[model samples]
Target: MEKNELGMTHKKKEFSEWYPELLIRSEFIDYSLVSGAIVFRPSAYFAWEIIKDYVDKEFKKIGIENVYFPLFIPESLLLKEAEHFEGFSPEVAWVTHAGKSELSERLAVRPTSETIMYYSYAKWIRSWRDLPLRYNQWNNVVRWEFKNPTPFIRTREFLWNEGHSVFASEQEARAERDQILGIYLKALRELTCLYGIVGKKTDYEKFAGAVESYSIELVMPDGWCVQGPDFHYDGQNFSKAFDIKFINKESKEEYAYQNTYAISTRVLGVMVATHSDDKGLVLPPKLAQKQVVIVPIPARSEDIDKKLQDYSEKVLNTLKEHGLRAFIDNRDNYTPGYKFNEWELKGVPFRLEIGKKELESNTVVIAIRDTSEKKGVSLDKLIEAIDNEIEAMHNRLYENSKRMVQSFIHNIESYDELKKNIANGGIYHAPWCGSTDCEIKIKQETGAKITNIPLDQSDLHGRCIYCNKEARYMANFARSY
Candidate 1:
């Protein structure tokens, strides 16, 4: 079947099926020959570039430098951090032999960079002057999972930036963790048009061996709550494990405080699931490679052909002049409706249609993808209209999803309520006494685990929804992806 013929007829009707289909049709990713891996096509690659460029700049603003680490870890090194190794052992892919010759020690393909990256950090730090060593690496990690891989969301191999840093004191490390998360919050808003909940994960859900882990969670259209980007604070746990220490001003040695964070291609999955609709992807202007698509409507009258082409080029040039990612579809074989469908499925933010009627009226008709609104735009005000409409659409997407994030959250006041509503999907906010047993009970019975405790809810409390004990904090719960 031709690409346009498929036309995304089932998107809103069946989103789970729609998302993967849109991803494949839109040329974002495809299943690879290797199990649990995907080939990132241009659409996915370019979007990652925009994200990488933005966050790289933001990281530099806070003194985080970029670095690269080896992709293989020695067996001895991987065993250094006991808790981390134990947590990751099942998923680690070990290289037992070097093709023809068997190696003396096994090397595990990097599941996460902590073991290898920190091995280097131990060598570089000597004194208090080298206290805070902030570095970030853009690379791929392999977690060989047994579950069914879903492209960007759950692939065995995926691209991500793992940021690692060291600090002199626990206070300094904790502050850096939050500072890094703040940078992520800004980037997420500008890049994805996402508004997410800020919180710290429960002890059971926190990062392996980290003192505390924090997250910015987003609710998708399918009612799943996923952690987007996050920061982790390691209070000497790793430094002690890896023996990373520095001399203090008093000439005594103390373990260095450390942290690590990640923002992966998984965000792409969340963005598509959050903002997209029936037609296809609804990319924010900032994330799109080509934000404006100009389709020259075919002229029925023979004399008006040149006028349509000429005016279309003029409008396209003006958009480019204003620094927009704009392209004009001057294909001779396709109809205007076909061009519209093509760009709509690709999620171009705005479509400018120029036809004989629009030329005669000295105006252009634009289709806003976010709202599916079409309006006639005056020729004199074309530039301003395009800029305004693009911004308006981003704002509209943000506001709509922002409301959905709040509205979908079900506040449960009792255990029965948790059991009844959890399977239906949505963020469940419930009061909880700080107890792992209660959390386990909820998960075993209802299949919802502790996602996070919002920073705002730390002080607010009541009776535990399950045990009726004094509540420690209100927490967010959901069946994660």
Candidate 2:
């Protein structure tokens, strides 16, 4: 098909415009009639499935089980936790009427399932035997955002997997929280080849009801940061709110410590923005729906076609036997060059091109999507080359991203420096005296917000950027999405 023209600008000129257009072009997602919502087409949904399957397997290995919860939470239950409710009320979507009749108590589409899930936990856990309830849900949530929404990034509704857990003590809860964060970090690195800064979000940036929160922030190609995954230590926040209590081995009753964490499809958007080029998406091989695409070049006589088809089957079986996601693009109408670009846009990791000449030589030509590297490999050593290419591509993606991340951070020791950095558009690292007034002052002056208070707390020798008071902590300040 000739390239369809839509309302999108060229990819090279405007990345922001290109993103939405490419999504539609790739059959990933599309806009819906409702404002701030989009429909996930097969391609995007399949990618999400790949991520979910791998992540779910990892969670299961760590003793977490999948579970589903109700979509509508009682207004009373959502409001039970006053602080949580206050934090969420501004963005909550309420259902006041059921069909034709108005209900006495309004219901809420879950902004998050913590309140509703914990209410059930309170009923289920009566003793220490039920101390650690490790459950996760693959579901969607709604939040009414006033700002303009980007697909996957800040939509009113989106898909995400939320993990909630309860433990007998603070120590166990904290450990689990960090453990989950570690898993998320590893998954991002392994599957997407994306690196991130692992640190704690500042009080203002922390999750609404969390006592403490940590996040992995992946840097996109344009130097903007995207939150990869997040972990929250609920502490007694949810337990006290929901009265989730249990009896100890000695028969004494106590509140259970808790934690909740989530990774969303927004992460897929981050990956696409980070790795994809003007041509199209350059998906990491591990996460690609189809890692290796085999295209037979040059039409041959029926007798030759039969022989080549037999050989192609052997190659496909070999790659599959080695556990690679491989596919054969057997359509006869398109030229080999057309198939090459199509697969490149789709970000298939390795493309194997075979023809009579190469078949006679007992070899195939391999092209990599990431680096556009090409080489000829003997059929016997194809699997080995494929393995090497995947590793090399991941290393390249990580190195390039790490370099871009370094460019986006500016170390600031004074208010003037903060102003300059903010104007230039990047994250500024500055010292703060741990005062709300000073933080607010900096924002009023620079239009920047405190994004993170790193757990690896480092004492700054310099004074606070705003009040010139004794600084306590080094904070990452930025203009966030």
Candidate 3:
């Protein structure tokens, strides 16, 4: 086979070159006519649809209703929240012209729906009876980021579920954080088969206009940290700005407390980068569109070829009946060897081979994707065997990701140690005194910034790694994506 035809030309260690090749060559996604945007292929979109469906079902169970907002936000509405507008100003794309004429008011493309969504929230929320309004929108947003885009990872436009919830009290709003974060964690574990660190963002790193922000952070193969799903507590900052006031239970008017959270398509990129290999993409069973592919070996005789085809069909049917996504690749143009390589590159979790021997024995040779272990399974017990293999593969992928992240973490006691090792890649667990100056100075001296102060603050004891002051929290610092 030619080098390009075989799969990725660059190995996983050559990440910068290899990642795009893996994504494009594997037919996962393609570059769009617009710069910094991508067109999701069938497999990539299928994975995202699975993720969306799972999250949407979870949200619906918790009383979060789905709704859609206008894609354009007027500049006046965006400027209602000064801090929020300022924070997003640089990247906010605007629509100032309609045909040949310039519009009277500039409309900012939806960098986020907070400004536009809350406008209606202010109007709709008028009485205590409308105390808690939980709404979520699964939509796309444009940020027009200047940095080089890496498909879903750093795209100028991306899809996500923006969850905006309003409550009559701060206590009620605050309580939603854990429930929502728990849902994201479960989705990452069950759907993506990935692990992440959940933590609180520092004041300097918190969302603009939010009282506090919390995120699920994942470490990339290159040792860079990427912010995953995040929840923000907008403690009446947006409510006051947009006049989202409601009558209290005590018969008094009060500003509504709010929260916003999201899980974007970016996690798909993270999953692809973390689990895939030099040969091609390595997808978890749940994320894979076709979990099993049955490729029948040609016998070069009409009678034997017919038998092999029949056996391959039988195997495919058995897997499908048990709720597995299975397909038969009996293309006459491609050799069995080519079919195996194609399916392997596409990251099908299991590949079943049916040949003369297997046909005679009423069995099929099953090949595992992550591990190249092949075993023969009788057709009668095929479903049971596949179920077990899927479970094992899922667990294996999650554990591998967890171990890789754990291995990259370095607990540093001094600033010098951090500077010397920050470039090598990995999360630096260090003590911080909770000062923005110390955070800034550390970031300036070393390119690493605080990823998050972990929710687990049980072992914080040492002095600040930079200022040498009494420690406030144990923060994970890393150069991020």
Candidate 4:
């Protein structure tokens, strides 16, 4: 009698059940004592570390230096920006007392860091040279979300990086916003093989105090078009509130143009939802903590078991020497069947199965998790084969995810058609006039909101999806998580 990990129920028949069940059973995350937060298990935290390490390097290259800021913001400073404060006030966690004494003013656990950071920026920046202040912070933010908490998605507190920058001119500020967003988009593809559509948020849906905002929308297994990561163009919004002004080249004191963006742990959720299947998790090699796992198959005879272990050790060393993250499963108590199921459930990008037939043939079986394809490779060429297989697996995951995301998109031409298909999940691309009232009506009629307005929009001369008014842009509509 052994306590083995549990496999998830059928994902297709019961996705909501399957999703959270696998996350907990796989030891990725656990529901914490805290009502709305989670303790990331070692397995899940390591994956997040891999992403942070890569992104941290990227930020350094672009001259965006990292620094830490106090987690609590005084109520007075938080309310300096009325819109930003109002938007997050409901969810803000306030500290009104210290031990037993009442505090003079409440301090808010930061829902976002704009107000606090900009207040310091005002004192730090004195002239034109200080104009391009590019600073980044990797920290936790508290929002006290009330909705059902999902691991790595909706939580009261989450790990996220907020990159704030200042520029002397409008052009520089705008360009930097787009450039930083490009970095995040690249991070998604290279890190997780997740595909998404980049679009501008409507005025109503844009960041509370941002001049403009954009999001990358992906279709989950349940067909909801959810946003994982997003960026904002602050455009002197916070600078004005906090008086972050500097002397210009022309010797004029002016407010600095600014921008801030946040990419959170929720991205890992998107990767899991998009790529994992009925069998178990299917991880992208780049972010997988243990990229490759080799399981040694013990023979019935003692002599054969000894030979297999020796060979498996050599194979494990070879893979490690090639700069691969790998592990060898040589635990005697577990059967080979148990090992296979265990690694597959963990989503190791590739697995090595070594046995007697392969030893005589001088070959080893390679299992590709993403495609569930197994092949035999010559022992002499094992390193080269694994490298190539890993690359192929990454490409396949990206292509398959891209295809699925494209399949969920339906272009709507009629309001009745929208109502008929609202329940059927997916992103509906439809023409709409730029009107908040029209947008509200659409939400009332259909639960879906206009998530984004695509950057490269189609010609817009038709009637709005709701009001029959002139269509201004092709907006993405979906019921989101």
Candidate 5:
């Protein structure tokens, strides 16, 4: 086999090296000319589109309308909310000049759309009838992160849905949290085939200017935690800052309760890291660009070669007619083994081998990507078999993710245990008194910050791990990506 067809140079266990190798070698994504930015190849982009479309459809069902905002926000608008501006200032990229001349007011490449979107919200909203303004935008934002960039994870520029919602009361605003989080969770499970810990953020760890924040936390294969989709209850912070007021039924002006939530390309990174292996990418069947690849293994004889080619096309059409993304590799230069290795590296969920034997028997040998399982299915039963295989592969990946995440969660009773176990990357589930002092000390001493306080607060009986004060909510602490 050629060096290019031999698969990844680094093993999945050597994650630091293996990750980029797999993604690049498999042609999933590529490093861009600009630093901290990446070009998502067809496979990666297709996966994101699947995720984005799924979430968008769900959003529309729940009355969230899609809208687009300008890529740049005026510096004055960003500074309207002091805390929001402060949180993003370090990462914000500025556009001080247009072509050659300096602009009077500098424009910030949007780190988040809260300021820009809310500015319009204040103008559009006027009465109680416009109580709930649930608007979301699918856009790209530039953060210009100083830390070392990871493709899809911590890039300088990334794409996401910035869902900004306005409601009449705090109750209405807070209620939207679960609905949005549920959509994200469903996308992770059904499309990404992954699991996450749904939890509330600590005050110190919450989104800047949010009254309270919630997140879906996912753990990587390396055992480090990375946050997934998140929802924030902003209360009246942005409404007050931007003056998004509405007249109530009693003819009184009141600030709108607000919430913001997002699911980003970062989760795509988590999905890739969690499910992929040394062979190459291991994409879920639903998210694969080409779910099935039919490779015709010709016997060199003219008669057999023609038969294999015709049979492969028939199988491709059959799968496609049944709504499967299928393709045929009938290239003359490459051998069957080479094609198999190449497709496997590219992470096609299923490979159909149609050769002389399959042509004679009217069957194709299906190769499952994730498990490397092979079985021959008759042409008539091929579609059903592929559907079953897709479901099975999705379930297996999801289960694996669930099991791995569960294993990383450790219930600790003492601070000593936390300090000892913190080095081995995983979430340390320990008691907290809700003090920033303890949160800071734990991070400083052990390098583990609070990931979140899980919604499931059962068995909340223990002393604070650090200060030994009465425990409040149980928090998950981990060294994150």
Candidate 6:
């Protein structure tokens, strides 16, 4: 079957099935030999590279250095922190044997590098000079998840950049936490024009060892929520547990404050789900590998073909001169329709069509993948026209997704409305009394989980939505991916 004609399930019709199938059929990822792992294809990995480059440059600008930590953590070290160990123990993958020998103490595959990194920091940090050590690592980490693996969303192993930092003062650590989250927000905006709601996760949803946690939640096309750019203020929890102490300039010893921020490859998943449509992927211009693809419609005569070929090259070179990624699609075999489908499916942001008439008129036909809008542009205005299309496409996507998110969020004051909204696949925001029993009761009645508690805010509503008692916090609840 033709790539576009394949009997694929429509994403809106059956999002659960279509999401995975799109990942496979689009050649973004493939099932690995290992049951729960996936092989990331060039298209997906290229998007990841774009994200990595953007995030890495931001980190460097802020004086954070990249470093590598071991993939395996000793069992003792992994279990050093009581709450953290308990939290991750179920999902921790263990390395029990080595070279046909049974190890005395099985090592745990690094679900996260917190326990191991903090353990090392204890010894390396001796004075206040080493107090604010910031390190980030880009690598794959494993957690033996029992659920089915969804390529970028949930998997036994996935690639991510984890930022770990230690500071002598809580104020410094808090500032670092917020700064990194802001960087993530900026990177998302720069790359995908995606905006996220910034808030703090509730006690039940916070990280394993964090004292307080903040998150940026992105609303997906399906009305589900994906947590992005999580920042955890450790408040000397790990530092104290692991004895990560340093001598202050005042000759006093104190525990170091820790902060960590992480944005996973999962954000790529969010990008694909949010922007892509029934046709195929709809990539943001900044992240697309081929921003503009030049296709020359074949002419009957060899002389015409030669002119078209030369014209296509000229257009490609002009785009390159203007700092846009451009390529000439000069395959002699494939039809123009096929080329269009392939490029659209691949999510090229812009397509420049050079033909006999266009070459004679000193114009090129521009087709944008995001909106499927086509227009003829003079060669003189080609660069400016292309840039304008990209900006408009990004704005179109941002606004569309923003509208979807705003519509999905329902502020419910009544219990029945909360249940009905959540059952109908809406993210519900309601005031709560801040009791664990109330939170659990809501979960038991509705399948939705409390996602975030808006941070640094005063009281919004007068009374609790659920219990009629005085409200403690305004909690945002949603069914997450």
Candidate number with greatest lDDT: 3
Which window of ten consecutive residues has the lowest lDDT sum in model 2? 1-10
Assess candidate 2 and give its lDDT.
0.82
Off by over 4 Å in 6: 1-11, 456-459
lDDT of 4 by residue, 163-282 (tens): 999999889888886777787888888877888889999998888899999898877777787776788888888888889899998889999998888788888887887788877788
lDDT of each: 0.85, 0.82, 0.92, 0.84, 0.91, 0.84
**Which consecutive 10 residues in model 4 have the weakest lDDT in total?**
1-10
Runs of candidate 2 with Cα error greater than 4 angstroms are 2-9, 299-310
lDDT of predicted model 1: 0.85
Q: Name the regions of candidate 5 deviating beyond 4 angstroms.
A: 1-6
Mark the 10 consecutive residues where model 3 has the least summed lDDT.
1-10
Per-residue CA lDDT of model 2 for 349-426, tens digit only, reads 789988887778888899888778789999999989999998999888767767767788888888888786575567
Q: Write the per-residue lDDT of candidate 1 for residues 11-111, one digit (tens) a residue.
A: 56586788788887766678778988988877778888999898889899889999988999999999998899888999999999987999999999999
Count the clashes in each prediction: 0, 0, 0, 0, 0, 0
Show where candidate 3 strays beyond 4 Å.
1-4
TM-score of 4: 0.97
Model 2, C-alpha of 425: deviation from truth (Å): 2.9
Instruction: Give the per-residue Cα lDDT of candidate 1 at 127.
Output: 98
What is the lDDT for 370 in model 2?
Answer: 78
For model 2, what is the error of residue 215's alpha carbon versus the real structure, in angstroms, after optimal superposition? 1.4
The predicted structure with the larger TM-score, 1 or 2, is 1
Q: How far is candidate 5 from the true structure (C-alpha RMSD, Å)?
A: 1.0
Which 10-residue window of candidate 5 scores lowest in summed lDDT? 1-10
